[model samples]
Target: MIQVDRLTKRYGSFKAVDGITFSVGRGEIVGLLGPNGAGKTTTMRVLTTFLGPTSGRATLAGHDVLDEPLEVRRRVGYLPENVPLYLEMRVREYLLYRAKLKDVPRSRRRAAIHEVITRCRLGDVEDRILGHLSKGFRQRVGLAEAMVHDPDILILDEPTAGLDPIQIREVRALIRELGDRHTILLSTHIMSEVEAVCGRVIIIAKGKIAVDDRLDRLRSESSIVLEARGPADAIRRGLESVPGVEHVVQAKVEGDYAAFEIHTKNGSDLREELAQRVLQNGWPLRQLDIRRTTLEDRFIQAVTRETISAEAEREAV
Candidate 1:
């Protein structure tokens, strides 16, 4: 479990993280989803005690990040955005070295190294030189290094960045496997990666927490996209009569058929009502559906709204 309260971080006149607060439960995987310059990495640094906050506090698994830095470090495994790796050493050698560095007691170092090597699926390159490994392999080594200490909390920053489709799936699988046993705070700019790996998402913009919610909840707030092949006029009139249906637009045109999108409350499912309405109106329904907005859509919509709101405030001055 981790808790961050009113955490603020400043550099001169600029703030990197502004009064943000959130909590992560034991074995829960939460994502920090945002664009570049959103201060996600800066906030993660503060959580891991790599950088002190300008104000407020962050405690990981109940150990104050500032008061008990060493303890927090021991309990947290951090894979920074730009993973620091020593390529000169063999894959296994580098991990063993980091295991020791993380103070994985000398007695347990051998097993710890082996545990992470296997956990991160670094078998083929275990004996190969780190410099000789592919980008995917190097990423595995970096992940292995993070797990060397057997920490309970894993904070991975863009762990799947630059990986190909197959490689990304493998890494995502590894993260999910780890999530079963560790509390996870995943930070990434890749929307698909977050959607594939994270259960909850936290959006940060302009050095502040904009929104934090379950992925499912965020999508529920997006516009509903629907498709129906029927007499356009009847379909539109019946759909318009439905309460909570704010607006409907023809999204696509395919000969005699058409695609319609209904913007409703948080993209709520309106197909059943739409079906009934179309039936009563005697308009043959071809497609009445609500497409679940993806994490990408939700992220863009939510973050853009926040940025626009903030900009408007400044412009109003």
Candidate 2:
């Protein structure tokens, strides 16, 4: 439902986004991830029609972002990182106003506003002034306004930015519920948010695309965790000589138990073999479990690799 092709955005001599391309399919939730100054917001702005790309193209639901901006806007619901809201207005009143601005038919405006209020769980605060609401409520109000028009695609940037743990969980749950019906392109610096909600991840670094793949595949690329109740050196020696184990890094030695993060070749599962070795040696086994790679790991690896490659290119030039 969303497509970006070699898109680039520049401000004077600086390139905020450089030749990045990706797409979001119908009913898919994709996360756009990056550190600060990593061009994530730039790319989202170009897609939302707030900024034009210096060169290249982007389309939302078959309408060219540059040529059919109005049409694109009609199909897209964007909630920026800092949601712009009229604080003095009541929640319901503001949503009604946004519905009108989005060109929701006057005849159906009431229904549209009601639907979003319900979807965003704003029933209790619908009549409360936005300024008096908590930060979490205000965030929900912003979300309600964004989807008041029931657009085809939802582009949310940092949807759970400043909320406490409870509020963050609430917002993440709502986003997941929305994903069932909307083609969502989520952008955030929170790795856990992406891990919790996004099916695919796109990591951008230094104005370029770094990694784009399914979340499951990325996690499978991480190392395994193995711990045993034996001498640290003995455990390390046994694991090191294992057929599939490529590298072993000692983690800790607590009492009789020793822990190591085992990097195996081709993402192998060697739990059974490791346990059998421990049993053969008559060493007590404490814990032999997989510590699945997290989204944070994949993100760090991507950004670090990109930085290294960029430095190498600059040196060669």
Candidate 3:
């Protein structure tokens, strides 16, 4: 229910988001991941109508973010990294106030506030002051405020930023539950969170879209790890000769045994062939396994590739 095409946001001469385009279908939970200052927050702000794009276009639920900002706001609920809250107000009181501000009808405001309080697990602390609540509870209060109006889309930036492990798990579970009803675009530094709750991942680097793919498909990419004893050069040559083997790089050596990571073409598994080659060469095989690619691996690879490309462009100039 969100569409962004060639979106760019700039401050003076610095571009925070540069010509990036992507979309999130209805009820889809997509993770927006990147390193610090990589434009993740900038992109969310633009989508939420808190900041306008310098160029390009974005629409939420068929409403243009620039031309129809009020309509876009009505459909989007935003929970920024540092949630704006009234610490003096009680939890339920704060949510009630937010509902009114979001234009919840006077008749329905009470019901909306109550529903979000229950969903966000603020039943016990609904009467407690926001400032008196713990970090975790305060976060829940922020989430309740965002949902007070029952928006169709939720744009959350660092929903689990400062919470402890238990609180993080709680927030992750809540986000997963919310995905069933709302189209969510989440930004966070935690890879495991994305792996846990997000079906798809869009990784940004250097103000550009680096990788966008399904989590299962990205994890399907794999490589082989081999460790054996005999002659390092011979083992390397034998592995390089195997069909589908893309590159063989020596990982480390411990006495006579050496470890080599075998990168393969098309995510191929060559453990059996590598093992047979080791047996034919009279090498004592110690380890043979397939190492599946992880979200973190893909993230680092994409960011590294972007950095390398930027360096090359500078060098060419």
Best by TM-score: 3
lDDT by residue (109-199, candidate 1, tens digit) is 8888888888988877799987788888788888888888989899998898888989989999999999988999999888777778888
**Candidate 2 Cα deviation (angstroms), residue 5:** 0.9
TM-score, cand. 2: 0.83
List all candidate RMSDs to the true structure: 4.1, 4.2, 2.3
Whole-model lDDT values for every prediction = 0.84, 0.90, 0.92
| Steric clash pairs (candidate 3) | none
Higher-ranked by TM-score: 1 or 2:
2
lDDT of 3 by residue, 77-148 (tens): 999998888899998888877888899999998889889989999999999988888999988888888888
Positional deviation of residue 23's Cα in model 1 after best superposition, in angstroms = 0.8
Quick one: ranking by TM-score, best first?
3, 2, 1
Query: What ranges in model 2 sit over 4 Å off?
Result: 224-265, 270-291
When 2 and 3 are scored with lDDT, the better candidate is 3
- Full candidate order by lDDT, most accurate first: 3, 2, 1
Q: Give lDDT tens digits, candidate 2, residues 1-317.
A: 99899999999978899899898899999999999989999999999999999999999999999999999999999999988989999999999888888999999998899899999999999999999999999999989988988999999999999899999999999999999889999999889899999999999998899999999898787666777787889889988888998999999988888898988898889888877887888788877778778788878988998889878988998
